[model samples]
Target: MKKTINWKFTLILLTVGFMTAVQYNSMKNPKERDTRDIWAVRHELAVEKQLHSELLSEIRELDKTIFTYKSLNDENTGKALTETVDKLYSQAGMTNIQGTGIIIKVKPSAESEAFGIPVTDVSPDLLTRFVNEINRFKGLILEIDGKRFTTLSSIRDINGITTVNGLNVSTPPVSMKIISPSFKDSEKLYSYLAASTIHDDFYIDNLILEVGKPERFVEIHGSPEMFENQFLKELPKGE
Candidate 1:
């Protein structure tokens, strides 16, 4: 009985050893071979991530390049943008269409103040001098008392109505529209006119002045070639 039990125990130990050896061999050289596959998959994924990052970076650079190209192509991009916005404003009926410039409406003071002063306070010579002064600053005169500079003067003898320089301009209080490049120039001209000796003895009461561009006028086309070199330098490569 003792020999039989020892042999049984020895067989059990040998079976356990053989099972352990099989498991070790299987781990060492697996049939499915998933060990190297896991490492390879991880490496591939890492490479793919790196490649994706690189592609994304390159795409960002491409977007910048496209922006630069567009900016270079449009020399008047800022003006174009402004026009677009203005057009939108017009479409919305929020834009006021009027001539832009300084409107100097100089009228004679009340008759109660001075008796000798004539109703037509602003003389033609004084008007001419004012116009000349405005011209010195490159200001373009648009209208004088509802009469454009291009039109001819009219006279009405029957009703004692007379017009000078195509405008039914009154002597004391004259209304004129002068367009200058800037409000500063307009204000300067206005100050000079107001302080001049020509208007010293006159009873000037109402003086209305405003500055802005006219909505409707003959469009003046500027030369693009005037800034050709600047445009060229601003142009994109190969454009």
Candidate 2:
């Protein structure tokens, strides 16, 4: 009878051990699966964030490039660039414009009475004296009739053969344009020239005067300090 009891007890103990082992294994499987699922979600989120950061960086770079290109293509920007270039050119002593100013045109007097001499036959010295007088008033010559003047402007003989500088350009029935900074100075100059003996036989007329506008061509070269300040202050940081 004792042997029979011992056998029954052993069987019961074995059954309890087997059931505990199975239950523990089942719970562990589910916990392990949950851990793996969490890991996968975190990994996917990391990848998505990395991709988003890369896309954002690319977008920022593209914006900068587009802005730069559009600024260069704009007309106002072009004008500014041209003006900057002109300033540099002036500093280099390669420009023709001396200063900001206006252009004034003067026409010769028309005569109804014939002086028995053709207008073209008039002495070239008269024209030379007139040009000299205007220059004395600090006038910069632009044109005489169709002739264009430059930094090295000069007068030539009516025969169009000889060149003269610092003298009245010898020509008949002269038409000329002058560039000056002051309208008052230009008017005074006209008054002086008209009252002088040079225009005694000719009528003096003011044709047109053109003033400089605020808009001008400019070109900026090299990285300026202002750009450095702007760049440093506006630089983007990483995500």
Candidate 3:
């Protein structure tokens, strides 16, 4: 009777252990699957972005060709040719963009926890300071959190949160894309940020800077038309 009782207890223990392992495996498998799905989504998004950039470039080239033909014929409307080109480039976020640029990624500091410091959230002041620093180096075409910076775009602090171009920065590792016509132009921005990484600008805010190499292609996306804020002013009278 004692031997039978012991054998039954051992069997039950084995069964419970096996069930627990299966449950753990089941939970882990879904997490892995979710990770794969997330990666796939990111890959799709990048591909679509590249396609859109190509299409925009082609459209701009066609428009330039048409404008050039008008100018060669000395058309009156050609007088605004230069102005129109500038407007198109501004709208496309490609003004004076002769070459590629660097992408600076700012992430939450990893060692903050180890040092018993908590500064996980990115502050508006940090974003503004970063923008100012890059601009100081003549970094053209500044974009933060995928929102291209225009003359009207700004970083604002509201209710203890940071908003860039009126959008909340709810994620870690904010990306800043900067384009310059000269490699040296982008390089200056890159070098400044690289050197600043070791400075207190990042340490005080608990941030990590990752300045990527000069990419061959960098297309900063503009805001949608819905985001346009119309300023009220009297229009200039047409002659």
Say which candidate scores most in lDDT: 3
The deviation in Å at residue 96 for candidate 2 is 9.6
Query: For model 3, what is the alpha-carbon lDDT of residue 144?
Result: 77
Clashes of 3: 0
The weakest ten consecutive residues by lDDT in model 2 span 218-227
Worst 10 residues of 3 by lDDT: 90-99
Of 1 and 3, the candidate ahead on lDDT is: 3
Q: What does the lDDT read for residue 128 in candidate 2?
A: 59
lDDT of 2: 0.49
Error of 2 at 188 (Å): 1.7
List the global CA lDDT of all models: 0.52, 0.49, 0.72
**RMSD, each candidate, Å?**
31.0, 33.4, 21.9
Candidate number with greatest TM-score: 3
> Mind sharing the TM-score for model 3?
0.56
What's the distance in Å from true for residue 23, model 1? Answer: 99
Off by over 4 Å in 1: 1-100, 110-118, 150-162, 201-239
lDDT of 1 by residue, 1-239 (tens): 99999999999999999999999999998888555777899988887886797689869966875575577546777665676567544433243333335566666554533554435344455555555455545435455565544212223322343444433466535566665455565567567666665454333422222323332332222111211234444557788
In the predicted model 3, the residue pairs found to clash are: none
User: For model 3, what is the alpha-carbon lDDT of residue 128?
Assistant: 71
- Model 3, C-alpha of 158: deviation from truth (Å): 2.2
